[model samples]
Target: MKIAIIGAGAMGSLFGGRLALAGEEVWLLDVWEEHVRAINDKGLAIAAADRDIVARPKATTRLEDIGTAELVIVFVKSTATAKAAETALSLLGPDTAVLTLQNGYGNAEAIAAAVGAGRVIAGTTAQGATLLGPGRIMHGGSGETHIGELGGGLTARLEKIAACLTRAGIQTVADDNVASLIWGKLIVNVGINALTGITGLKNGELAEHDETRQVLALAVEEAVRVADAAGVKLPYGDPVEKVLAVAVATAQNRSSMLQDLSGGRMTEIEAINGALVREGERYGVATPVNRVLTLLIKALEKLPRENRP
Candidate 1:
């Protein structure tokens, strides 16, 4: 298969490296010149628990160099989804499938607008990865990925892609209720990401403290109400319970938002929690908790390096 990874960041490098190691014809496309040069010169280095891997996948900083791909996997931050999809249109073949494993809501819609809805696959993954440096990533943990067409039905294409991901060591499930799956991921992020970023706590530590737990509950509960009001039936029966469960499962991990905050990079606060606030307003649902978190995180982003918490 000819594959192109659009973002080529931490998760993008991890996914592209695994597929390249599995012998697929993969090309990693990114705007970061340093990372691209590093991968092209040496290789993508993945630091794992038991072993480290260096996979030589073709990489490019220029979009024109990417060529056409049968599959394009988008791992850009949610804020960059539209621009990434627009830029990636040059790499799509006539029958190319665009898969978005991005966080938060509305990414699929943005990609669909650029690449056509029929060819878009909306999905989420629990897999964790941290970028160690240019062309290097730490495989934080392994988890399941779920994907499906936006309109919701299983197709041969979806199944085939899931099988390929599984072969590359990512356990994947082809789901019909992909929207619910996406919402489930959003709930988890709403509960965990900002809380972790604010308190400088690991996922497990959020569960250990009463104050943090109350804050997490406030965020999750408000998000659940807003999601329900918007007609999104979350897959989990009790969304708060599900969020806490994921906190336990990935206890030692620092969230992507926290990572960005610590590195003085822009966090996806507008996409995750801010999206909730936006939807809550549209549906006339109260989401004060999410709104507060959104504001606090945005405030933190503006802090000077020496003053940041």
Candidate 2:
């Protein structure tokens, strides 16, 4: 299969490297010149708990270099989805599948506007990765990946992509109700990401403290109510418990939001918590906790580097 990763960041590089190691023809496209040059020179170095290996995948800053690809996986920040989709036109063929495993809501809609709804696949992944440096990535954790058509149902194309990813060691499922999967993951993020981003605490620490745990429960409950009002069915039974379980499972990991804040980069608060606030208002559900978290993160975003919490 010919594959193209639209954003060659940590997650993008990890997926690209795994597919390349499985003998797929993969091209990593990114705007970062330094990262591209490093990968082209030394290959992609992947460090994990059980093993370390270098996978050779083509890397480039130019989209034309990749031409048309059979699969295009988008891993860019939610803020960049629109621009990335527009730029990805050069690599889209009629049969190409555009999969977005990015964080937050509305990504599928944004991509669909450019690539057409029929060609877009929306999904979520529990896999975690961090960029150690240029051309180097750490596979921090792994989990099931779910994908499906925007309109739902188990299509042949969805199963084919799932099979391809599974063959590359990424356990993927072609779910019939992918919206539940997306919303389930979003609720987990709503409970964990903002709190960790604000306190600079590790995932497990949120559950360790009573005060933080209570606050987390409140935020997750509000999100659940909003989801209920929106008529979205969550995959899990207890949203708060699910979030806590995930935090405990990934105890040592620092969330993407925390990593962004610490590095003085913009966080995805708008897409996560802010999206919840908007949905809550639209559905006439109150989401005070999520609203507050959204404002706090936005305020943090505007602070000077030295002034940020």
Candidate of highest TM-score? 2
**Which 10-residue span in candidate 2 carries the lowest summed lDDT?**
300-309
Tell me the tens digit of each residue's lDDT in model 1 across 46-101. 98878999998899888887788899999999888989999778988888999999
Score each candidate by Cα lDDT: 0.89, 0.90
Assess every candidate by TM-score: 0.95, 0.96
Candidate 1: count the clashes: 0
Error of 2 at 32 (Å): 1.1
Candidate 2 structure lDDT:
0.90
- Candidate 1 ranges beyond 4 A from true positions: none
Best by lDDT: 2
